[model samples]
Target: MIAINNLTFEIGARALYDEANWHIKPGEKIGLIGANGTGKTTLLKLIVGDYKPTSGTISKSKELTIGYLNQDLLSYASDKSILHVAMEAFDRQNQLHTEIETLLKKLETDYSEDLLNKLSDKQQEFEALDGYNIEYKAHEILAGLGFSDVDQERKLSTFSGGWRMRVMLAKILLQAPDILLLDEPTNHLDLPSIQWLEDYLKNFEGAIVIVSHDRWFLDKVINRTVESRKGKLTVYAGNYTFYLEEKSLREEIQRGEFKNQQAKIKQEERLIERFRAKASKAKMAQSRIKMLDKMERVDDVDDDNPSVNFNFKFTKQSGRHVINIENLGKSYPNLEILDHANAVIEKGDKIALIGANGRGKSTLLRIIAGADKTFTGKSDTGYNVTQTFFAQHQLESLHLESEILQELQTFAPKHTDTELRSILGSFLFTGDDVFKKIKVLSGGEKSRVALAKALTADANFLILDEPTNHLDMQSVNILIQALQQYEGTFIAVSHDRYFLDNIANKIWYIEDHKIKEYPGTYAEYEEWQNKRKLQPKTAAPAPQPKKEEKKPVVQQPTEDKSKQLKKLNQDLGRMEQQISDLEKEVKQLETKLADDSIYSNANKLKETNSAYQQKQSALKQVQQQWETLAEQIMELEA
Candidate 1:
């Protein structure tokens, strides 16, 4: 348990927290939330002693231990395997294992009773500490976080930053500290991994304090919500949805009180003014002024909800079919991402493409955008379809030397500066912020600018890949509103379930190298998928015992189809295992792609690109095989 009493933390002259109080009780799951720069992460650090408060105390019991997971841990690197890294959490067990190994070597030489006795004692301690099962525990946690057994054996330094973060998270979970302080833990996680974490944290025996902008995650995982706003730590005795309702009611009550107090203050001032003009009533006015000065004036409630007004109009209109894909085949090394897969994107289709990481969601987005033309298939756009694409990588394309206003001006030559500033304002950049150079802006600021450019492209079709990355909750809401009001067709890949649910009318997911569609919102898709998964499993009929004399026999359609489908699925599973390796390799290559040393050099970039293409080619070949096998199964079923 930890108690923060009258805590006051300051940065320079500005107080990030003033007289804030919070008590993290045992087994309490708390969601720490607020706008950007609200010090949510700082508060967690304060609790973990990373930062000292300007005043007041944070009290914790001597037995309390904490496991903090932050963005900084993404830099963690080691030659050791991830399994070994995670096993490091079991300090005593690991120490005993080392000591036991040393004793075994010693006994081979001395063979003394004293040495044998020490070895026996050490073995007992190790067994009691579950030393033998430490590796298995580490593997289980890593698997839950989306790592395979083979991946656990790979060096930690070989993983991408996101995967490395997962390693650190696994290490923390293995530690089983008394409390967990997770900062944007889901930022690097895919949907399946996020769901796995939700389940794990739901049953976690210790207390948890999570700082994330993911509304759906908070609503599902936390029992309490703490808002770090207006330099105060406000507590809501419920989850995010409950906090919204309760905050609205409290604000309504506060508004009434504020109005009443304002009226009383005006009346008092009027009386004081009238009495001051009269010499005979001067003493009475003086007394009233003193009383008014001492009065406790109620503060008006701040605006909690801000509206966005943007009319995204395009000069051209797309045809009935926005896009059509046929016999699409894409691969990367051993990963058969999409093999002869097919899908159609009709006009007005607001689709959310989501799945586990490395599922080719981003890759598909690129193919749709025509940015990557490596796929072997037809990806045709409808008539008069002017399109815009938004992705995390586009942030690097911005002119760092240009001001925010200038960047938009160059991108939207037709729009006036005033109109551009208005668009920026809707994204929470106001006045002088538009004048600041893009180079000086933070990642979130650059993201907003990039998004603003994408919206003003005057395109009827949009292909957005992870557009919500680096955006805060407010910006996400603004995007949701802008997309809601726009009359355009778009497909986006995102892990933010709340954003997807609000903006998408259809869900698109890739499975076994094929793109599948659900004509419903994300929530509905989840329900449907869950039901499909929960369907009762029955054993498939075995092949009729060997036919006598090699005679041809009629086959049962249902049983034959089931057998074929099962075989096809098993093949897909084997391919997926191979994909695990290629996925990691591709991620490593991508991490290299983001490196300045590689991209800044033409030769190195060319070499990396060539190697990348080779891997992709290999993956596509395997993916094509998937289509071959799948087609056979489909034929048998037909």
Candidate 2:
């Protein structure tokens, strides 16, 4: 656990945190959220001791181990297998393995009590730490993260940067430190991988503080929220949605208080001016003047800037059949990603394309966007369907040497510099920020620039791939609202369930080389999938003597099924116990909270309140898991 006390961090003349105070508790999951340039990553560095606060202290528990996963992926030049890299997380276990091997060799050479004792100790420690299961767990985690068993043995250097980041992430999760600090851990992950991480972190025993842009992931994984803003930190007792509501109320209250104080000051000033010359009232006027002078001015509340005003100007409306594809087939030299695919995109259709990674979602988008002509498919756009394609790597298309303003001008050649600046401001780039070179901009900044340029294009149809990849939560919401209002037909491939749920009117789910169209939002599609899963199976076939002889073939599957059920039952028991323990702790905290004297101490009150909330959150999570397991057990029994 770490405590940030009166922390003041500054860069040049800008104070990011001005005497900000926050407490991080054990076993609490917190989502660190803010807009770009709000120092979320800087706070993580401060907690990890990589950066010192300009003033004040970051006190940490002496025995706590903190694991930090930075945005930069580890680059391995050596031929270390991916599994070996993950296994490196357990360095102590590896050392014990080596010691035990050496002791065994020595015993074979010459028997000695010392060697025997050393071997015994090392073996016991290894078994206690589940050393024998390390490799199996590593593979299991890798598979869950979308890496195949064969891929685990491949050299780390063979993987893409995104996949390599997964390798690093797997290692960090294996370490299981006391506090996990992850900055944009979902940046490189696809949808399935993000879901896997959410499940893993939900059951993680230690504290977690993650800064992520994925709203659904944050909502599912974190119990508390912290916002970093203009020279201060604000803590909310619940997740992102709760934070939004509480923050709005807080701003409203602050604004009201400020207005009231200003009115009182104005009244006092008028009274003083009117009574200054009256000798009888002069003393009273002076006292009122002193009171006004001593009153601490209320600062204006901070809020988001005006929402970006965005509207799509269509060159021409597309025909009813906006896009039509027939017998679509795409393949590499050794792999056929898509085969005999067919689909149609009607005018005004807002489609969300979703599937596991490498399932041809992006490839299909490319074919439809006319960016990939190599595919064997009759893909065509309808009459007057001008399209603007924004790929996942679209930011790379920005001219790195050009300023943001200049790039915007390139797209809108007739617009004057003043007009360009106004448009740039709409995308949250104002003042000198527009003058920054694209090379110097952060990923989020570049993403905004790409989006701005995309908006300036003369197109009626949009094809976007992972459009929300590098955007912050606010920017994503902005884009979502903009798309909602746009009249153009669009197809977007995104991992953000929240965004898709908000904007997608139709779901085109890609799986096993085919696209299945569902006419509803992502939430509706989820309901359909759940219902499909719960349908009963057909009756079993009648048994025969020859079928009995084939029992050996099916016997292994039954044993594996039994093992899985046993594990689930064990997990259920553990969760039940955990829920009971957390309930007790919550009661204890509530008792302490009832002590009115603690409210007088600001630090004690904050700590006690945070502890109680954390306990309640932990209990809720455990109870949810318990119910989930109970349902699964019931289904298995049935």
Best by the lDDT measure: 1
The 10 consecutive residues of candidate 2 with the worst lDDT sum are 536-545
Worst 10 residues of 1 by lDDT: 534-543
Off by over 4 Å in 1: 537-638
Model 2 earns a TM-score of 0.80
lDDT of 1 by residue, 161-259 (tens): 999999999999999999999999999999999999999999999999999989999999999999999789999999999999999999999999999
Candidate models: Cα lDDT each: 0.88, 0.84
- How good is model 1 by TM-score? 0.85
lDDT of 2 by residue, 53-135 (tens): 99999999899998889875555454799999999999999999999888888898878887888889999999999999999
**Highest TM-score: which candidate?**
1
Candidate 2: deviation at residue 148, Å? 0.6
